[model samples]
Target: MAECDAEWELCKENIQPLRQGRSVSALHQALCQQQEGNHTALNQQKQSVHQTSRLYFTFESELRLYDGDDPLDVWVRCGLLG
Candidate 1:
């Protein structure tokens, strides 16, 4: 959990400056620039809200996986390993 928070903080620190600058706006404009029938507009809207929230919740849920044994499939057993 701490590791995930640290990584997220590091990423935010690195991205903060660009987000504060006009680069983010320009990037958004570039991404949104499309034809009338293009699906980019709808996709961007969905990603901006729904997808972002889903990803955040997913990250939080992933922390629970670290509470016990290793998360890899090899560690899971049907009954008893012995």
Candidate 2:
């Protein structure tokens, strides 16, 4: 994590020259938001993904790819429903 923080510092240094009319504070805010997922958007996205995956796995009817009855579903459902 410290190594990654050092790399983030290097990235901030490298980006300093690119800002023309931009405020240093704005640049700092953007960097802080992006550094190692320290942003609200990342948390929101993670929550969204978690909810989606839970819904996906809970709905075994959709996951039933084959046409006929699958015996594996019984065992899996037994575990999940327990």
> Using TM-score as the measure, which candidate wins?
2
Question: Residue 54 CA error for candidate 2 (Å)?
Answer: 0.3
lDDT of each structure? Answer: 0.60, 0.69
Candidate 2 C-alpha error for residue 57, in Å: 0.9
TM-score of model 1 relative to the true fold? 0.27
Off by over 4 Å in 1: 1-43, 68-82
Clash pairs for candidate 1: none
Pairs of residues clashing in candidate 2: none
Alpha-carbon TM-score of each model against the true structure: 0.27, 0.33
Q: What is the lDDT of candidate 1?
A: 0.60
What is the C-alpha local distance difference test score of candidate 2?
0.69
